[model samples]
Target: MKKLINKLLVNHSLIYKLFLYIATIILVVYLFPKGGQFKYEFQKGKPWQYENYYAPFDFAIQKTETEIENEKQQITQNSKHFFEYNEEIVERVKNEVTQKSTEVFQNSELSQEEKLDLNTRIATILATIYQYGYIEASSESKIEKAAITLRKGNKIEEIQPYKLFTSSQILNFLNSKIGTQPYTEVQNQLLNILYDAIKPNVSFDEVFTQKTLEENLNKISYTKGLVSENERIILKGDIVEGENLRVLNSIKNEFESQIWSKSNYNWIVFGYTILVALAFLMLFLFLRKYRLDIFENNNKVTFIFFNIILIVLLITIIVKYDAQYVYVAPIVILPLVLKAFFDARLGLFSHVLTVLLLGFIVPNSFEFIFLQIIAGIVTILTISELYKRANLFISVLQITFVYFIAYFAFSIIQEGNASNLNWEKFLYFALNGAATLFVLPLIYIFERLFGLISDESLKELSNTNSKLLRELAEKAPGTFQHSLQVANLAEASANEIHANAMLVRTGALYHDIGKMDNPMYFTENQSTNVNPHNELTPRDSAHIIINHIIKGVELAKKHHLPDRIIDFIRTHHGTSLVYYFYKKEEEYTGEDVDESYFQYPGPIPFSKETAILMMCDAVEAASKSIKEPTAQAFDALVEKIVNKQMEDGQFMNADITFKELQIIKKVLKKKLKNIYHLRIEYPE
Candidate 1:
């Protein structure tokens, strides 16, 4: 059973991928809020374009947000504030005042009768003030009316029209009754005496007030009067004003909220499944037809599907939470990122599929799809050569502008006037464009996650200032210069043949890093023409030369260079015979020599980029030996050397055509001639 399962997994991998892809999309769709989707798209202050609407059943009209807010305001304003009577505060103030009066009388030089008269007056004044409630001034602003409880010995009575006194009012009442002139010092003394005694008998009850307000607000009906079955709700061409638009929106919401019958749900799910399946099927078919390379690789296929699903899921989340800012979701990043690694067509296609899936959940499906599709196309057109920093900035700018234009045009069409256009939406577009700039960095992350390479990474690796390449120039200037010449030749040839010029150029730069290990032994770096090979036997010299390839692989691995770049080091020599050393060995021994002793340890060039690097390396090095340094001599040198390498079956594994090889030969001949100061057909 396990063997059978393994066989099934291997044999039906594409089917499994398709199943998973479909399942993921369906899962994301199910995760979205199924009720928010509305069939008709409407705008306020615009005439209803659809046919006359009617209520099919006795459904209540949903209230507008403005109406509900107005009702809540009424509830808040009319709700009476509750106040609790604190008899302890009143009694404490009275006791404090009595004690203060006693202290003042003791400090005064008045007789007992005068002090007694002053105490009696103070007691009368306190009684007058305590009769009214003293509330803290801060609480007075928050209360419209207060429910005050007056108590008289075991009997409680509720009072209305009770005037609450603030601290200032109490002081003012005391001063007016006690007389302000001639006894001003006494009055001031008494005011300071009463400062600590003033307290609020009535305190605002926030919990009670809030609870009452909420209960009142909850009593306000959310739904207005019901429309009977088959009643005409609104006629065609009627301008949807505040109340009418609210009713229409409410009916639409309630209609969408209703669940399908249990039996009918199967058909609904089936229909929804078919629609989504068709959309994804179109995307899959597009890949299968035009992008079979990506379709064949399961990782690339998974990456595409993952991006699509992620974008859709984000839109779904936005739609469920806040649909107005859906434009801020950075949908354009999809095309921008895909185009960064892949081509414009695949990027644009994937973006369209993502937008189409999102349309099911967002309001106004047609407008959403139209705007996103146009923005995606703009993204593809403006974004080119993303490796350059300026290109990304300019491309994002253009994409933002396109989004603004498309949205503005749609709004004008929908509203029939520019006056009603929501300009704030353009801010979301700007944010999206800014967010899309992150795709540049995200491209690096995607490369690591997917084991893919992009032009931006290639450009960075190709920099001469890079640590490894800089070390190569400093340590082995001769080999460094040779690598540069070969890079130019390979890049030119790759471009002519419609190959990855950046990849081939990068490969050429690092192809000869192994020569850096023994730069002095190579003829290019020797200043005095002292040959290192002279002291060594032919076999020893051959051994040193052949070991460079192996040393290069180790160095490349140590430097953490990509395997693609290391491939050039492994295949550049391509098991070719070291002709000079082998000939010398034959002359020294006068016997048939072992070919393995003279051949490079190689798997040979298995790709066009590595093959091109091999040819350019040999051609550039041999061109320096041309004594005449003329165009004809350079041409002869290039052809003779390239033909011999070809005859040795070095290029058998490389996926290069004969026609491409001829183009490469022509480019190399021209480049070599230019190197020798010969004026070829192509000008500098």
Candidate 2:
């Protein structure tokens, strides 16, 4: 069973597609009978049964009322004993003042003046009650009359009432009575006064009058029963007569019977899915027409595998996110990235197909889908011809502006209000724009790992990494100088042809790397004294000269330079003969030497850039052999060499047409003529 599972899961053959088809058929079978499976539901019934589950209008109204009632009840409960504790504290203080006044007035050891003064103080305290609307008492207020007023006054009615005080005020009042005094004796007297005046109000009859816990619980139960009764009344259904019951049963029976019937709606989804898949496949084919050549080279399998990974990644994104915005990310970035590394028409076609698929997958809203397509089309168009990182950055900025405008357009259409303008929306726009910026570098990395070269790769190749150039300088100075001249000449011609000039220049720099293996055999490194070729036959010298092209290709492969650079090394010499040695052989042998042995391995240039490099290499070498430099001589030399290559079919495989080749030759001639022009004589 495990082995079967592994085969089903891991196999990528046609059997897996068959398994997927069967699984999808089973899923459709199960899902079709489940009503509302893909539709929105507003009510819960059986776990999978369809019912509208929206909150009813009556329920919403009742919910609002219930919340309001709960809030009012909370307020009432909180205020129930809010003032009771404050009343008790005030009564206790009044009683204490009365008892202390009586004790002071009745003391016989006191002088008559002191007794009169105490009596006057008590009278003054009692008189001030009308002015303050409450009896203000102090430590000395203990006369019998004041005690009578406190004991007899009604606790709820006669006490000078104040609103409930907070806990902090009560503690402050108590502390004032015992300031700097031991609190033990003072507390006992205060407790005695509290017991006499307030304890009566707090007894079983007065303080325990509120409802008990059991009573409140019973009330809650009765209230809940009443609410249930109300709900039952509202939702109640009436029994039907015999004929009505038969009609109702007939309707339900029809619904259950039709639940699993064949659906044109499901067919629509399946048909659209198949159409989208075919459209994308066509787009892939259209974009890769040039890829037929690559495919013929036995790399088709790798190419197919790479595209399969891209398709899977796109599909996974659609399934996992299922958001309208998410679909845009892949469609916008993937096509442009494909164009950058592969071909442009394919990118455009892929973008169109991606938009179509997104429309099907997220069928409801067109606003987000339209915005995404616009952003994607603009971004891809902006970066379509980019060949440098700075160009990419500028393109990203342009895309960001387009994205901002697209998002704002969406907001305007969705809300029909300009007030939606705010920093948050701007922030979201900027963040999404930044996300698009991040996608470019990631696409670069993905292409790199797949053995695909992008504009970034060409730019890096153009830059002379100091370390590698230094190695070339130390080991092969003559090859280094030759490479530099070739780079300058090729770069100029490439610019004229509108090819990738950087790639052309960089390829020229390393094209002769293999010449370093036998530096003296090449004329560039030979000293006037050392003539190794003098002892060898002309055929032997020619063979050694042509071997450098093969050797350079081998060294290039070892260093893992991309196929673009490798092609430069192979084709820069084309099938052109080593003319000097060929002439030498003709003179010495007096017989036709096999020209094939003297030619560089003969798969000629395959691109405009390579063809230009080939032209530059020949012209630069021929210029070095010129005894006298002159504008007419330089022009004649360039024209003769290019015309010879054209007649010999060296440019046949290259994409450059005769018109572009002519332009390249003219540009090279003009440059070389200037370089060889005689300096004007200055009057002495």
Candidate 3:
């Protein structure tokens, strides 16, 4: 039992990866639509790929989106708008007008016949205005010069509304009606009082109108006609066009929607799970084969998985809400982030696979996949350095352009004209490009969350004026200068062999920071002829020399440097001996000295950058001692040192090839000869 637990603990990383893959597969499969898929693939302009197709069941032909939209719009346009006739308002206006007219006539200078005739005329005019109906002010736009239907009690009548008036317009309407007739001052006063008493008797029936509109919209037939069973839809080698295309799509929809039964639903889910699992498996296999270094670290593997899942979830959610906006989700962000942290190949590969999965959910699956895959390729190719703001902006612009061009090409092929292109999709692509710029800050966020480092961070760390590098210059000027020379050499060597020059240069700058603890013990910081190591025993001097690696690591940690930079300090010396003191101790005692006391505690170089630093560091420090530098002498020195380090197994763990080492050796020799001017100005 104890042995089994120990074995489990030893292989914990593998187990974590297994669990991660399974969980990712399950989550992505769950995100897929539960509906079963149609087996046939059809396109409008392309010939039918399947055998002669026929309607297997009695399913009705479905309407296109444009057809459905047109139907609903026609319902809104042709259907009459209804307005309510307020009987209460009309009745109130009648009583007030009659009472006020009687009061005004009581003080009139007219005889009874004149008063009665005037009262009858007023009543008739008010009745005419009310019969025409005054609509509410808020409903003006709904009945905007259009014919309105007036509903009074249980009766409905359609009216032209040529004389409709709101509350504000009532006074002008009353004046218009009475301005033609001669009237007494008392008669005019009564008309004014009746004007205040009348209210808008017509109001838009908003609730009823909306309810009717919805009912009409719902009653619209989504299916125009039905296809009989066993009817030949289209023959093989026939281009699907017009009604034939519509019928085929209708049958596919009906088949997919109707076939989702209890037994088949689980089968669909299982099939999706298998496909999704296979995609993830391919990604893992590619990582293990091509990126073994990244594959070994579980953190990096988890970070990669997180990025893939991030894009998948983002696109999936947007598609679920409205598939029309799927292009605006910024699929290029996946490759941008991965390329920033890892490499372009991995980024592009992951993006392609993830997008293929999204094709199942987004509208226009073929167009979407092709556009995104091409965009991913463009993103990886254009953006070499992510730290520069201008580079990212330009790359994003290029990526957006690629998206636009690919989509335009596809649109023209299908529609056969640029006029038929959906220009609205170009706006979405522009937004996608704009959103891709967020990768710069997003990378910083990833760096913080995952404890990862990127080119941006490396650029910042490589700055010579930073706090740590500045301190190294102040306390140990010679070592600082030595680090600078090593940085230049390692950077050049890295570039020569197609390795990471920026990373190698940055690592070289901090590799000797450990020597800052006691600068005089090493010869580099000795300005005056006083040596601090003369009074101490050989072992003591060796101990002080070896402790610098430990001290540098502590200072780096104290200053919160990333672990990637700290690895350089730890592995620069690679367990090589402090041979100067060991030889002196042997001469003084005439006996063998213990090698352990003179050796640096090392984990060796584990990457191309670190291994290059190891070679350059040793060569640069040793070259300063050559008094009579020559081409032959520089070549001999570089060869001897690199060969000695290789013999000591210093580069066994590093991912460096022998051919790459030869290239680096040539670069170092050329650089050394150039430093001392041994080589001529022109190469032979």
- Give each model a TM-score: 0.78, 0.62, 0.95
Q: How many clashes does the backbone of model 1 have?
A: 0
As a whole number from 0 to 100, the lDDT of residue 435 in candidate 3 is: 86
Residue-by-residue lDDT tens digits, candidate 3, 1-684: 999999999999999999999999988988888875677776667888889988888989999999999888988888778899888888888888888888887877889987877777777778887877887788877875457878898888877767677777777667766545675587579768877787788888988888888998889889989899999999999987789889988988886577467988888888899899989999999999999988989999999999888888998899889888989988888988988888989999999999988877776788888888989888888998888889989888888888888988888877767888888899999998888888888989999999988899999999999999999999999999999999999999998888888888888999888888898888999999999898999999999999999999998889888898899999998989998899999998899878998999998898888899998999998999999988888999999999999999999999889999999999999998887785447866
Cα deviation of 522, candidate 1, in Å: 5.4
Give each prediction's root-mean-square deviation over alpha carbons.
5.7, 13.6, 3.0
Candidate ordering by lDDT (highest first):
3, 1, 2
The 0-to-1 C-alpha lDDT of every candidate, in the order given, reads 0.81, 0.58, 0.87
Per-residue C-alpha lDDT of model 1 across residues 355-463, encoded as one tens digit per residue: 8778777877778899899988988888778888898899888888888888888788666789988888989888888888888788889888987778898898899
Q: Cα deviation of 218 in candidate 1 (Å)?
A: 3.6
From the highest TM-score down, the ranking of the candidates is: 3, 1, 2
Q: Cα lDDT of model 1 overall?
A: 0.81
Which of candidates 1 and 3 is the stronger one according to lDDT? 3
- Report the C-alpha displacement of residue 423, candidate 3, in angstroms: 0.8
